[model samples]
Target: MTDRFRELVVNDSLVDIQYKTDPPTETVSPRVTYDRDDVPHVYCMKKTIPLSAFMERYARGEQRMWLAAYRPSNGRQTTITFAKHDRLTFGKRFIDAVAAERAHLFAPAQDSDGDASAPPPISSKKTAEVSSKAAKKISLEELELSLALQREIGRLGEDAAYRHEYVRLHALDCPNPAEHIVRISEDDVGAGYDMRSTFAGQTRYIEVKASTTRMDSFYISENERDTLAKVGQEAFIYLCRVDRDAPKNSAVVREIRDPMNPESGILLEAVAYKAKLSN
Candidate 1:
């Protein structure tokens, strides 16, 4: 039997084996002895029959075995389990799945040419050129429009903050109060445009003017004026008044109702109304 056991060990890695006959309800410690060379020699416990029986079956080729090792950090004795064929098969399938998932996760991104080689230098240069072209350019009309829009945006921002705080403090606010939306100039286009929140909503367009007082009129580009006329009654004009000295939080927003006529390119009488911040 010992010689048969030696043959069974040919392809197996040596491991410490602990065994129990009764089903384990909790962990248990068994006394073990090792040879002077540190090889496990004997296992003694309340149920040593299972370990002996397993060895016998393995030698007779009547059972298969798989070994696993574990080490605990709390200075507790390490443990190894000798699992049978069914458990070993389950463990192998689980390990294979985990390995496949890990390989997929760490897979490298493919290059444009479908190879792993680094991208060409000209590709980077082309990207830089495209970016430079998209950068905003300074034109006289764009510069004037941007300055005006900036002033309006600054004023609207303050008004919004004040209104938000005011509403928070006074809970009895109206169902629909007032709202402000500010956008700065970009793409070398500084014209103000109106956007309706919904298809059925009223149209509101704003042309901002920033000055010491409301005395100076600002320029409205051809495109800006055309957009306003197209929207009809839904269109409105927003006037922002700013003081250069009091730049921070220094402006006020006022709206002028339907201020343009598309068919006749005429400017309608400006009916200025103060912006309400509640909504």
Candidate 2:
């Protein structure tokens, strides 16, 4: 049976959506222009966006939805906006109705092109990123193992980076550099910092993140978050962006200081929590 698509109309605007089977949940910005018939029949909405972008926008904010589409005659694609609450309600109803009818498709697309003012739609131009918290199945052991491996890799990168920094300081002949440069990752005693180092008499705490891919995003533990808040300028995140296949000492180190500030635009997503039974 063919899968059905869902549709909703809002403020003279029509929004239509369906799920794609793509595994990578990254938003693919619309690249090519689609003809009027190719676009969805929603009020001036285009059908060029991937399912990932929809979910990404939903992740950032559930109150609204964004769509990529443009007028039929107009060539430029535009972002169409709508209230998600109302539209999603209609969508659930549509799905239930189709299911009641034992329809092969859950929410089939409608041929009704929206109001005349609505234009033919174009695909999305932005790629949206998926968050790890999104519902996906995995065994508890697998999850723990994956996390442990990631942490171990990160620690390796962090240790390498710290040693590199230490060597640089020693080369500079800084006063008792060995006394100042210390690895603190061994204990919670150092708080959220992974390594403590001094340069020109000032002490700085460093947190490290190691990634095989370019760091478009990274995880920040609650300890790191709180440490940033408390220490302010003294705290730094040393991003060890490594090309694993490359020879040794080839990782690019980028430092982000005071990342917890509101202007940083860093999103803190809670992936795990400790449960406490109520008394």
TM-scores, one per candidate: 0.29, 0.45
Error of 2 at 89 (Å): 50
- How many steric clashes between backbone atoms does each model show? 3, 18
Name the regions of candidate 2 deviating beyond 4 angstroms: 1-141, 167-172, 243-247, 250-252, 269-279
Best by lDDT: 2
Q: Please provide, for model 1 over 129-167, each residue's C-alpha lDDT reduced to its tens digit, 9 standing for 90 to 100.
A: 213534422323223323444644445544433443234
Per-residue lDDT of 1-279 in model 2, one digit per residue for the tens? 112222333322332232221233222221232234443223223444433233333332234344554443444444444332222212233323333432321223455674333222213332233357552333232233345446546766776677667776888887666777778877664478788888786777888888866788887778778987788877777878654334265453777777888766667888778999999
The lDDT for every candidate, in the order shown, is 0.38, 0.51
Among the numbered candidates, top TM-score falls to 2
